[model samples]
Target: MTAHVVQRSTAETTLMRQFETEKLSSSPRRADAFGRFIAGGLPTRRVESWHYTDLRAAMRDAAPLAPAPDSGAIEDARAILTDRKRMAAWRIVLVDGRLVAELCDQFPPAVSFSREEPSPVDVDDPMVALNEAMSVEAYVLKVADGARVEGLIEITHISTAKDARSVYSRVAILLGIGASASLIESYLGAGPGVQRNSLAILTLAEGARAKHVVLVEDDAELHIESRLGQLAAGAELNDFVLISGGALTRRQLFHKLIGPEAKITLGGLTLLDGKRRSDTTLQVVHAAEAGTSREYYRAIVDDEAVGTFQGKVIVENAAQKTDGAMKSQAVLLSPRAQMNAKPELEILADDVVCGHGATVGSLDPEQLFYMMTRSLDRDEAESMLLEAFGEEAIRRIEDDVLAEALRRPFWAWLARERVARVGGEGEIHWVESAS
Candidate 1:
């Protein structure tokens, strides 16, 4: 199981010949998007949505530079964005990836924006041409027509140390007709050689509505890759993702409905222990006419960690009454931890109603001997039957302090992998069986 093949270095072609003339202002579409980010320079695993995260061999021993703006690393990224107490609404701060316009704030001039340049399907995506030749700044937010944004809209990606820093950060969200909102993208950190690269673009008009949340805790030797896009027309998108810490964590979500009754809801949660690694990739495109998509993913791999889920649903042919469903599930508790699920469905509408499902198991020894016959023990009956199968997928996140703050680091990584599998702190036997 080995993978790594990424090109275009010479310090990323001399940092794209110095941001190709400062991203050609007065746009010729930003000079053909800086010539399509100098012809793509960062996505590898030969693409297919980055086939299981391979940012050019994890930044090919990264060091293409971009991390020297320290004010004690912006006061340790403003004390981890003021200890995010379920932080809601208004925030757009970027440290290592630049953009801290005096701690960001000011945008409601009937919300309008620009600075979008880079396309040619992003020239075989080298992390979208290294975030379009090292993006210096961009935070376009528009929510005009029928706007209703009373709370929640945070975008904070702070970091300190953990070298190899390259942040081509961009966030352009446009929501108009019947507008509504909630956007949260937080990636925090605290030392230990980190690398962060991100890109986000969202647009929704006709009947627009949105709710997107992404949080990646840092410093388990951080390495993160993120890309997102959700377009509209009768729009309704609710995407959620959470990954605890990181050694190598990847997240990508792309959805294009285009118009007609569009609706999309994709959720994901990953908690990998020790030798950490988490990857979540999803793509859904109906492209007009009765569009509807729903995807659900859950993972919990213990020590020697590794979790990956690749989900796809594409229904073209003018998407006739499309209604798609995708589900990927996993629950592995060590035994050299690892979980991989791939769910796919691509149908050229035959009056479409697509389907996909995948499951990887472990931990249900009859619900831990019926919660150890009632009095719970065996690591509290396997953490109460793995928190009742992760509280049936975190009660489908209807937000309760953000689902108990994402289940408190997934129950402290299942009580430290149940004391590394009963080497101690074991006993709470409440034996009872049935069902």
Candidate 2:
């Protein structure tokens, strides 16, 4: 009998060594997760879900684990946080994957936070297992039952690693029955060679409502974020993600409607420039009757950048009268830019309505010419069209404040795009006016 040995990459080998030294690996759950990751290794193009990204090939080697945040690093993070544009929200700070108490703002009576140990999840992905094994701690936020929070609860993750390193963080948000809240998860800073893995879990009880916004604008070389959500009967959730930074990024979303009459809206906007690559993959399951979902995504690819979107809507056998629609669109600004989109629908119930569509094309030359004739320069006209293209997804947000806050980053990215189009010589700046 011949035995076949699985070949491990340098990054996998490094991860094994790091796991051995970590204190968290002593727990049985963590040990089991590490074993699972070792067995499967990193996902490759051969994996249907990861076919477009090829994470195993991209991660040639892994960096050392980031150290605990020291006083100097905390001060630097504080300065950065202070300089950023202020929004009306309650802030929680995490530096180098560790929560900083002094930097956080006081929460209202309806909201509470605590530190908890990472628990086992039902997800089958290797990356999720790795996060479970390597995460130092999990931050848990709970909204009291029937409480209506006034402002957003923002979790700001600041990476201050000046050298090549890896960081892992976990967050869980639970909303009680009849509770309503808004959340913002922002990723900022990190050296050019840093690698980060972040996980967020959301659970909503019956009659709960939530709005979630994720902003990825860090300088990490490799960034991967996984979001898991479960909704109960009569619950509603709206999730939006904006990707405009990082050299290589993959965002994964898994959501399930576990109870009848649940609703969900998933939207994303990706801005790809230079040689950056961004991939957004998602799966939504309608497991109960009369559930509703809408998935809309858009991307702008320029230079030699590449963008990928893969989404699937599943209607289970018991999910009668389920309604779902998914659409993905992209505009390529350069001849070398690339956009790949794959949308799928699986229906087991006869009374379900499910469909998906994808489209990729370049900007309209006639529109550009028309805008130019109206005294607008080429860059200005292009920016206007691109803004309108991306705004469609943003417009789905119901909250005016949250929608405007998310728009600031989009406007900033467009300003930078304009600068790159003309010449990459000047310092790009964008200021929000006091309207």
- Among these predictions, the greatest lDDT belongs to 2
| lDDT by residue (tens digit), candidate 2, 103-171 | 999999889888986344578888988999898878888999999998988899999888899989899
398 Cα displacement, candidate 1 (Å): 28
Position 289, candidate 2: lDDT: 98
What local distance difference test score does each model get? Answer: 0.69, 0.88
Which ten-residue region of model 1 has the weakest summed lDDT?
Answer: 426-435
Judged by TM-score, which candidate is best? 2
**What lDDT score goes with residue 138 in model 2?**
88
List residue ranges in candidate 1 displaced over 4 A.
1-119, 122-130, 135-164, 167-191, 198-224, 227-244, 247-252, 257-268, 272-285, 288-292, 299-318, 325-369, 374-380, 387-416, 420-435
Candidate 2 regions with alpha-carbon error over 4 angstroms? 1-4, 424-435
| TM-score for all models, in order of appearance | 0.32, 0.96
Candidate 1: tens digits of C-alpha lDDT, residues 148-235: 8776767777766656555556666778888887777777773556556677767778888877777777763535454555556678
**Candidate 2 has which clashing residue pairs, if any?**
none
- Model 1, residue 395: what's the lDDT? 57
